[model samples]
Target: MRVVRGREFVADRAWGAEDIASMNGVSTRLHWTDQPYKWHVNDGEEVFVVLDGKVEMFFRENGEEASVTLGVGDIFYASVGTEHVAHPVGEARILVVEKEGSV
Candidate 1:
């Protein structure tokens, strides 16, 4: 079993990325905080789990911009080619899991 302390993980500057497929279809936890006014697009589907604080997920659908606020324990999934931005309301800790061979 893999265990992580959220507080310490957040305090660290460099976080390592791991492959879940090597771990037998398991999910790995990740802590991330992006800069304000920045945006990202994923080539594949991804699930974001809010562990602490809040995050606003911004997206555009049908030429209209939309947003949703996600708090602790809230989860959101984004599909491939989805354009969006995430803004942390406070210091946010999130767990990112990629399914095996998903990419």
Candidate 2:
């Protein structure tokens, strides 16, 4: 069992994470970041949940760039082959669930 206080969590580097759980090849992680993540596609589905702070989520759609601002408690679902990146408004804590070993 584990308990994490998102507001109190910190990372060694941008996008650094704490492995929360793994079940049936899927993994759950808590991440802290003040920088943007690289645009990339996940091998499978991804669930992004904002735990604290805010984020501007950018993605490519129909070859055009698009984005949405996510606040605490907002959720973003990225299916396979969805090219997207996350830019934190400042420092943010996020909970991510996806296939293990996925980039």
Highest lDDT model number: 2
lDDT of 1: 0.66
Q: Which 10-residue span in candidate 1 carries the lowest summed lDDT?
A: 13-22
The TM-score leader among the candidates is 2
Candidate 2: regions farther than 4 A off: none
Root-mean-square deviation of Cα positions for candidate 1 versus the true structure, in angstroms: 3.7
Candidate 1 Cα errors over 4 Å, as ranges? 11-27, 99-103
Candidate 2 RMSD to the correct structure? 0.7
Per-residue lDDT of candidate 2, residues 11-66 (tens digit): 99999999999999999999999999999999999999999999999998779999
Q: What is the C-alpha lDDT of each candidate?
A: 0.66, 0.96
Report the Cα lDDT for candidate 2: 0.96
Question: Given candidate 1, what's the lDDT at residue 83?
Answer: 73
RMSD of each: 3.7, 0.7
Q: Work out how many backbone clashes candidate 2 has.
A: 0
Residues forming the 10-long window of minimal summed lDDT in candidate 2? 1-10
TM-score of each: 0.72, 0.97
